[model samples]
Every structure is written in structure tokens, then in C-alpha cells.
Target: MGQNISFNGTTGVNNDTERRIHIPLYFRILSVIEIPVMILTLVALCAVIKSQRSAPVFVIHLILSDFIQIICKLMITSEWIREVDAIFPILPDAFDYSLIAGLYFMACVAFERYLLVSHPIWYKSHHSLKVSCVVSVIVWFVPLIFTFSKYFDSLSVPIGCLIPYPIIILCFVGTRRGLSHAISLTSLKRKLILGRLFLVLLTYTFLIFPIVIMWFFSQIFPQFMFSSFSDVLYFFSHLMFLNPIADCLLYLFMRPDAGDLMKSVCCCCRTDTHQNSTHSRDEHSRDSRATFACCVSVQNPASHSQTACSSV
Candidate 1:
């Protein structure tokens, strides 16, 4: 997306020449970090797909989109594939397609949660796996169409990204308000739903929005934004890689057993305290049982009954 700005004119050409040595180094360093993360994301994707239990449809698509993104990004940044870019100039821009798809899926997830909480009857009756599948197909194609169309310029790209911003925000706010009145959801479920929405909003704002805003400005002030602030623009562009990693973590956080996983971690950290408390509880139970047995065996049963009732 920031490719145009990074290599636009004579000034950009000069800057590129100056940083020719450093750019490959930077990309290598990025690949080092991104490769492992990509592997981990792949492992997670396999696990999610193979499980017999059903996962939220949007979540699976979201992870798939992330995996595609990581692969595209690695190809785009790899120095060895510089030859491929020469033949297919559009190759470096491949990640944007998946990126936009991921954002749409993220919005879908937020909207689903919003409906689940805000309108339970409608969500329960109308929301189904088929509906989710159709929506996923549409989300994938919308970005594909945009990518092929001549109208999808720098300005349009930012506008497209901006389209989901308000949708996400509205869903988050609506869900928050709905939680107060939601009686069907348990307290833990409510918190997890709200948390997922919050994380989606947070990641989109901090990770994706900066590049979107940069693209918007680059369109409005081409020379100034690109030539004068090329380094800053480059930094904002690479900041996008973090989004896929965030998605992987979000997948883990959104798991049904995530709460149990957290509790187990907490227990592991407090083993000594728990053991001491358990021992004390066992001793108290034994003392109570012994007192009850002594009361039952007493000869003066009426007096002992009153005493046992008080002690027990």
C-alpha cells in the first residue's frame, strides 16, 4: 500500500538508493520474526480446522485471512523474491487484499456478537452456519473485486478500510449497552463477548488505522507526505505485520476454554497457597466429623443433641 510513496519520484529514487543496503537488512530482520509467527499461526489454524467441535465461523475465516496475510507479507518483503515483483508488479500489493478481507471478517464477528446480545431472538432464529458461510464468501469477493477494479486507488483503499471503522465502533458500543440488559448470557460469557469486541476495536485502531490515515494523507499531500516523511511512512507500513500476530493471539483469547486456561495458569502460580488452604480445610472437616461421632455415642442423648447442634 505504501509502495507508491516509498518509490515514487526522483526524491524517492534517491532515498531508495541511499537505503538500498539497509532495506534488505530490515526486511531480513522482519522475516526472521514473521516466519516463526507465521508457523505458529499455521499450527493454530490446523488445530482449529481439525477439531470435531464447531468453532465460530467468522473466527475460522479470520484466522485463514491472517494466514494468507502473513504469507503474502513474507513474499512481499523477501529480498530473494525481488525478481518475482519485477515480472508481476502487483505481487507486493497482494497482502492488501487479505488485509481488507480480514477487516471485513472482524467487523462481521463484532456485528454477530452485537446481534447475539442486543437482539437475542433475532440472532437465535436467523443466525446460522449457512448464513455465516454466505457472508464469508461475500466478504472474500468484495475485496477481490476492489483489487481488480481500476477505481481502487490510494484514496479508495483508505476509504474502503474506513468503511468498517464506524461499523466496528457501533457494534462495540451496542454490545456494551446490550450486556446490561442481556439475561440469557452468563456473566463469564458476557465478559468474553465484550472482551473480544474490545480487542477487535483496539487492534484495528492502533494497527490498521495508522496506515489508512497515512494513505489518506499521502493522497492529499503527495510530495509532502511521501518525500518529506518517507521514513515515517515506511514505519507505518511495516506496523501492519503486527495485525496478523494480534489475530492469532485473539483467536486463543476467544476460545471457549480460555477461561479455564487462565484459571489453570493462576492455580499453577499459587500452588503453595492452595496446598496450605487445602490442608487446613481437611483438618477442619476431620474435627467436625469426630465431634459429631462423639455426640452420637453419648449416653445423655437429649443434652448431647443440643450440644452437637451448637458445635456442628
Candidate 2:
């Protein structure tokens, strides 16, 4: 968020020259790109909600995080309708802080994947519905704890944002070991799984990694880095334009058979209800017949247990 540090502390284009260089630049980048990201998030959200499976839910969260980042970028890039920037000293910083929340969303997705692939059965059995809700909250909160001040400059930039960088950097782009458990497969299954891995790696590289780098550069050489890279970085910044489009394409179009695990829970619940209802009816009928037989035996002393039956 560092700018040319005008003689005045208020942020603005220093002059027509600087304005030409930077004003409306990053905003333009975000405005053009965010539409697609929003679209992708909605599409993926639909797919995941429809199925409620662990994998699809994770995908939805990732898309949502991307969407939020897109919004932060788009909002910052948007030209003000009035004199807000003149009044608000921290507008740009606000947008950047929101974007930090977006980064945490991605980290959550990666961790969820780790659980799903690393311990599928455990995730399926013990990672209850409540756990999902809790994790979602923590994902957003953890990043804020780490990066909010850095994003806002409301406080001195803390060191935690720096610590995660190396971890994020060292992450495997291609997963030779994404999943430890076996996914049932046919001849073509392995190929499709590999292809999906490749696409995921590409998405991380094309959309995520560059943004992180730009953030790094912006921090290191705040003014010059943003000034020099502003044009291309704003436009291409981790393919901001591609997110929604890719999200819709990959999540909805590509994986039609994606099952929602939540729905499975519902279905199972329904079956249990039906079985219990049927069992209760059978038990009631048996009790009624036994009572009728007992009465008949008392009255006529010749009731046959074999023929005992209730009319109802």
C-alpha cells in the first residue's frame, strides 16, 4: 500500500504523471477480473451444496476464498464516486486486509485436502457436521491473527505473515502423495486423478503463487514494485480474471458425478426413520393380537395361539 509519499500524507496520484502511471490501474485489473471469480464461486458453491461431500465442500471453500479476494481487488480498483479517499486515510489498507482473509481461505482448503486424502475414513467418521462449521470459522480467524495488521498498517506489520510464506512456498505443486487411502478405481481412474492434480497445480501456480510473490515484492520495495509492476500485475495478478470462469468450469462442468456427502446423511436419516416407523407398526400389531388371544382364552377357554390374529 506504500505510495509515492506525497508531500501531503493523504494518498493520491502525486500528479498527472503519477496518476497516469498508477491511478485506476490495479482497480481496473480487479474490476475486469472479479466478475468471473464471483461467477465461479457461485457455480462451485452450487455443486458442493448439492452434494455436500468433503472434496466438493473443500473446493467450494477455495472458490469462495478466491471470490472474496476478487471482491477486495475489484473494490479497491473501483474509482470512487466522490471524495472518500480524501477523507479516509486507510481505504487501500482496508481492501488489502480483506484480501488477507482471502489468503487464509486458501490455506484452509489445503488443510482440508490433507485431512480428506490423508485420513479419509477418519474424516468421514469423526469430522462431524459441527466440525465443518468450526473449521470454517477458524480458517478465516487464523489468517487474520497472522496478517491483518500487515494488511492494514493499523499496527506495525507483524512477523507471522512472513513465517507462513516459506511453508506455502515449499508446498508441493504436484502431489505424489495427496491421498494415503485408496480410492476405488477402474483403468481410466488413475489418469483422471492425475489430470485433476495437474489442473490443481496449475491453478495454484497461475492464480495463487503469483499473488503471493507480488505481495512479497510490494512489501520489499513498496513504491517502486507497485509502480513498475502495477500494470501487468494488476491485470494478470494470479489470473484474477480466470477464477470464476475456472471455478464454474472445473467444479460444475467437469465433475458432474460429484456426490454430496451431506445428502447421503439425509438419505440415511430418512431410511432410519422409515425402518423405525415400520418396526413400531409391527410391534403394535403383535401386541394387539396377543391381547385379543388372551381375552378369547379367558372367555371361551379354547383360543388357539396358532390362529390368533388382530383384525386391524
Candidate 3:
């Protein structure tokens, strides 16, 4: 029997156990790696919160969006595998907005980095806390304006929610282009480092570009044209979890300060670990030496070397 993804086209789409669930192997492979990705997100959020880092405020939002995505993925895995209800209830689409907020934060982080790197003076002079507060309000409110879908089933194009998208694309592209040109005149080693960072930023935008196209197509083709692809679109949306790895890569390669800090932390951890191991070995050796010395003292009843014996 040929399978279709829609169920009466009213509220829910019945995804094919074979087609939809077949899930391109790439996606499945990526999904398998999400556990550590989820953990990294929690740890990163906590670390950012405890310490006042540049753009730490947006880190909370980014982590939250990724967290929501992790929850959504878990739900998808469970709901699909368990085969519960065969149909999900129509619920408030809070996750929808949250995912968009995630994209917004992704752009926010990129530009934030660009500003700090390319125009530190301008960012410090103008992009202060007051401006950030206003900018955040704008980011949140724009999405709310386009919550046109009454419920999950009737979900419509989130039109007003995306006005900032072009600006985001521009900011990402412009920043990269500017950085590339500036780095070109520099030494080869610096250019290579900058090249790697640019690729990381480029990949971040690459993951985001699909959603932007989805929005454009939803507007152009009308809902009935292809609603079945929505869930797949939703899944592709979660791939931003890879951003942490990308962010870390860029940090290790491009940002010397961040790389140094990470190196220091890792070295400190290794040093502590090594010291603990060394101390344990020393303790064991000391105990053996003491036992042997005591035995010798008892047997020999007196040794000139006893004076040299000492407890560490």
C-alpha cells in the first residue's frame, strides 16, 4: 500500500512508519549524537550564567532554544517509537516560537562576535546594556506579532515574526565578507585561522538557511502545496545543536584568548588529575618503605640508615 503523510488534512499528518521514519541516514546519525550535545548545552549555559562573559545574556536564550529542541527530539523519538495515540493532540505551539527565538539568538551571537572582533570600539561605545535590552525586546516581540496559527493544526505562516531575518543574513554575510577582506592583507597563518573561523560562521548560517527557505516557500506555495514536509523541516531545525562544536572549533582556531582560556582550563584539570595520581603513588610507596623499614628495624634492631628514614 502506498503511504501518505497526512491524516484527513485537518489537524494531524500520519507520518509513514517507513517513509518518514526511514529518516535519511545522515539525520539518524546526527540524532544519535544529541545526548552529549544536550549535556554540553546545559553545562555551557550554567558556565555562562555564573560568569559574566560577553554576550552571556544571549547564551541563556540560545541554550533555552536548544534545550527546547532537545525536548522536542526526545518527544519525537518516544512518540514515534512507542506509537502512542497514533495521533498527537492539538496543543499550544510554544515550541514553534522558541525555535524561532533560537535562530534569532544564533544570529545575535554571530553579530555579537563580529562586533567584538571587527569593531570593538563601536560595540563598546554603543552596544551597551541599555541597547541590548531594547534589542532583546525587539527580537522577542517581532515573533509574537506573527503567531497567526490559532492552534497547532491551523498553524499558518509566521509572517511578521521574520522581518529580522534579512537583517540577520546581511549581518552574517557582511561580517564574513568584511573579515575575509581584512584578514587577506594579514599574514598567511592569521588568514588560515580566520578562514577556519569564517567557515564555522558560514556553516552556522548554512544550517539556518533551510528554515529561511521554508518560510519563503510557505509564503509562495500556499499551505496545501506541501504541508507534509513540515515535520521534516522541524527536524532539520534541530541540527543547530552542531553549533556548539562549531563554536568550539572557531574558539580553538581563531580566538587566541578563548583558546588560551580553554587550554588553561584543560591543563589545570590535567595537572590536578596528574597531581592526584602522583600523590596516590607517593602514598603507596611511602607505606611500603615504612613497612620495609619497620621490618628491617625489628630484624636488625638498629641501622644507621634509620636516621635517614623520614615520612613524606
What TM-score, over all chains together, does every model reach?
0.74, 0.56, 0.53
Per-model lDDT: 0.71, 0.50, 0.52
Q: Rank the candidates by TM-score, best first.
A: 1, 2, 3
Cα lDDT of candidate 1 equals 0.71
Model 2: per-residue Cα lDDT over 221-309, one tens digit each: 65564444655454444354464454444463236453343346568999999999999999999999999978878887433533464
**TM-score between model 2 and native:** 0.56
TM for candidate 1 is 0.74
> Of 1 and 2, which scores higher on TM-score?
1
When 2 and 3 are scored with TM-score, the better candidate is 2
- 254-277 in candidate 3: lDDT tens per residue? 332554665677799999999999
* Residue-by-residue lDDT tens digits, candidate 1, 151-201: 445455566677899999999999999998887777767777888899999
